[model samples]
Target: MILGLSKHPSDESIVEGILAGGRKEHEALVALYKKFHVSLERFIIHRSTGRDYAKQPEDIIWEAIEAFVVNVKKGSFTLKDATLETYLKSICKNLWFRYISQEASREERQNKYMAEWDKLEDDVSDMLIEKENWENYINLVNKLGKNCKQILDMRLIEGLSMQEISQKLIANGTFENDQTVRNAKSKCLKKIMELITSNHQ
Candidate 1:
């Protein structure tokens, strides 16, 4: 039989039951979670910064509770210095840090993939337009000068807005402003077209 509890059990008793494991362990952890879940969820929501992450507040709370139970059973939680709530918060905080780091890395990889895809778009444009003479088209595009290459790569291939490209170029001292970026794009497209026509002939 499980130990008796008139109402709220002491934290120490709950911890001991969990450490003992089996039916009593389940009862103790459930009781602990029921007693503190609302507060823990509130804490997670407050800390999540209005961003939906790998888990919702409730999910994080439950996961943390489960981990706490296991750790208590394994003797990893001494529970001598801090309250149970404090330890639970620590676990939740660690989860948030891990989620944020993973999200950042995922975003970085997506940006890199997008950049590469944009470059490929430029490389394959000619092939898409002139299926029969794709080889000649590719050869002609390869012969474009460095300036044309850069202009098209940024404007067409990279999918950057003209204003964005303009700011970047101006910052790099490549051009004076947005108008220059536009003019350069026009010239580059004209040159590429000329190369394609001449190669066709």
Candidate 2:
């Protein structure tokens, strides 16, 4: 109806046209967007309201559309028994869930770090109560060369995995593989820990 097809095309036909990779593909995508975009936006807005960590509804909707298109083209979406809208909505839901999970993890890490900071204060007493030692440790970490600092920051502060860090480093020509990143991380951490322990005594 939307695309002016003589009759309603099957989901398979539409998907095939999209995967065909030409002007037909472009028309298919436009047709899909016109058919679903408003409903998808409304659905996302309804679901994300009042959630502080939720992504902007527009962003979520657009990302969902992009994921859906890419996944469909890549054959990841089979569209076996479900309607296209249903499949798209499921993708949006999964994306929202991922966002929520990451937000929760970030908050949890922050709370844990805060509790550890308090304990460090108690353990060190007034001798280092002003957090001078903590500052010094930060300084030592900063002195550990740029790549080491970047690796540690990405892994610890950003909660990225070793493999992700390795890819980033490799892209920047820092090191070739995850093993190199791991070795560098271990060496940097050991150096910092040794510095702290020796200075504490």
Candidate 3:
């Protein structure tokens, strides 16, 4: 029988079943967790810096899902523009920001940085490559917010300038000014960097 974290016996009938947690509903939700929980956990785990925090990514995911269901029940949140999958990803990232301290050890991370650097064959390939270097980076970049992807695509990828990125952000209603776009871009890049380095092996 399935053991550990008790099963939520219902499917993700988010409106009724999840909000109304009887035995039948709860078990179904538990099964949902079993099905996707490990994948969600793996995403978060890849952001940690050590085994200590590696195991905690799932804890964060479960807590976030519970909180999401609660807020939806209370009408404090809605999935107007976001799909269920997108909503879940947001929760995962928010949890990382909220509980980052509990998620990783600094020394373990520093050692990892030393290793990535020590192993780097050349500078050209460190950030770009005809090699295996950019696989992880590309995947991580692919996971960014829509606005981020566009900005990077235009300015960094498509050879547009920061001014053009700002213009695009404004046109897309993501910002009212260039400074806001720049700041947002900086924050997004920082997040990407943090995720990339957090739990490197």
Candidate 4:
């Protein structure tokens, strides 16, 4: 049994302990995980059919628990209408659905990026074919940043999908997640276009 916790702590107490933070917070988070992880895992696995989850059910549940902790601390979660378990499950479901939605849109996003690249290539076909101009263009891309250059190289040169670039960036500890990768890619592409336009001018 965890010290400073009752045999069966009330939901209110658990919430209070989590908000209080420190040791109480730690204990409360452990308690919450112990109480809900299995149920949430089962919930996730049951709904995971035909979905490509980047994380396992256990990882997703733990991620949900961590998000719940942050929400509770930030007053985003209040145990007013729903029990802790119900509220947590809601968070898990929302997170799962959002992840799936992102996965579903990946192909569409990849096509859009490819179309944009194709248009850019058409616009600068003459310049791009010249060796010196191509080198200068690459130099402009390299100025964006290490990660930006890598992302563009993978997406544009290697023709990798955004999801693939996201995984690589995350693995390298360059970006936090796929959404961040998308944002960075968009910005990098825009910057490249501006640079190319200015360079030609």
lDDT of each: 0.73, 0.71, 0.62, 0.79
lDDT of 4 at 61: 81
Candidate 3 lDDT score relative to the true structure: 0.62
**Sort by lDDT, top down from the best:** 4, 1, 2, 3
Which candidate has the highest TM-score of all?
1
TM-score, cand. 3 = 0.39
Give the per-residue lDDT digits (tens) of candidate 1, residues 40-80: 88887787679667667777777788888778867788778
Residues 7-45 of candidate 3: C-alpha lDDT, one tens digit per residue: 432223443555556763465456656656777777777
Candidate number of the best lDDT: 4
Model 4, 1-201: lDDT tens digits are 653766677788789888888898888878888777888888877888755667677777877888988888788888886898898888899888777678769878888976886565445444555535767868888789888789878876787877888998999899998878877877777788788878778
Clashing pairs in 2: none
Q: Over 4 Å off in model 1, which ranges?
A: 1-3, 126-201
Residues 84-147 of candidate 2 have per-residue lDDT tens digits of 9898888888887688778889889867855664444334333333455646745766877788
In candidate 2, clashing pairs total 0
**Which scores better on lDDT, 1 or 3?**
1
Cα RMSDs, all models: 13.1, 9.5, 19.6, 8.1
TM-score of 2: 0.51
Clashing pairs in 4: none
Q: How many backbone clashes does every candidate have?
A: 0, 0, 15, 0
